[model samples]
Target: MVLVAVLVVVVVVVLFAVVDLGPPHATTNKAAIPNRLR
Candidate 1:
C-alpha cells in the first residue's frame, strides 16, 4: 500500500512537470507576421 501511494505521487509530479512544458499560446510566439497586402 505504501509503494502504491508513492507511485501515484510520482506519476502526478511528472504530469505536472509535463503540463508546465506544454506549447505556448499565440502571444508567446515571437515570430513576426507577414503582410499580404501589396
Candidate 2:
C-alpha cells in the first residue's frame, strides 16, 4: 500500500514535468503532422 502510494506520487510528478516540458514539442509535432500529410 505504501509502495503504491509512492508510485502514484512519482507518476503524478513525472506527468506534471512532462506537461510543463511538453508544449513546445507538442506544437512542433502538430505543425509537422500537417506537413507530413501534405
Candidate 3:
C-alpha cells in the first residue's frame, strides 16, 4: 500500500512536469516559442 501510494505520487508529479514541458502556450518566452511548437 505504501509503495503504491508512492508510485502514484511519482506518476502524478511526472505527468505535471511532462505537461509543462509539452505545452506551447503563447505566454512563454520568445526563445522557447520556437522549440515549444513541437
Q: Please name the candidate that would achieve the greatest lDDT relative to the true structure.
A: 2
Q: Write the per-residue lDDT of candidate 3 for residues 1-38, one digit (tens) a residue.
A: 99999999999987865675666555664556468667
Give the alpha-carbon lDDT of every model. 0.58, 0.72, 0.71
Scored against the true structure, residue 19 in model 2 reaches a CA lDDT of 65
Show the colliding residue pairs in model 2: none
Give the lowest summed-lDDT range of ten residues in model 2: 17-26
Error of 1 at 26 (Å): 24
Name model 3 segments beyond 4 Å from true: 23-38
RMSD of each: 11.6, 7.3, 7.2
Which residues of candidate 1, in runs, are more than 4 Å off?
23-38
Candidate achieving higher lDDT, 1 or 2: 2
> Against the correct fold, how does model 3 do in TM-score?
0.55
Put down candidate 1 lDDT per residue, 1-38, tens digits, no spaces. Answer: 99999999999986764565445546532332222111
lDDT of 2 by residue, 1-38 (tens): 99999999999987865665555485576676566568
TM-score of each: 0.54, 0.55, 0.55
- Residue-level lDDT for 35 in candidate 2: 66
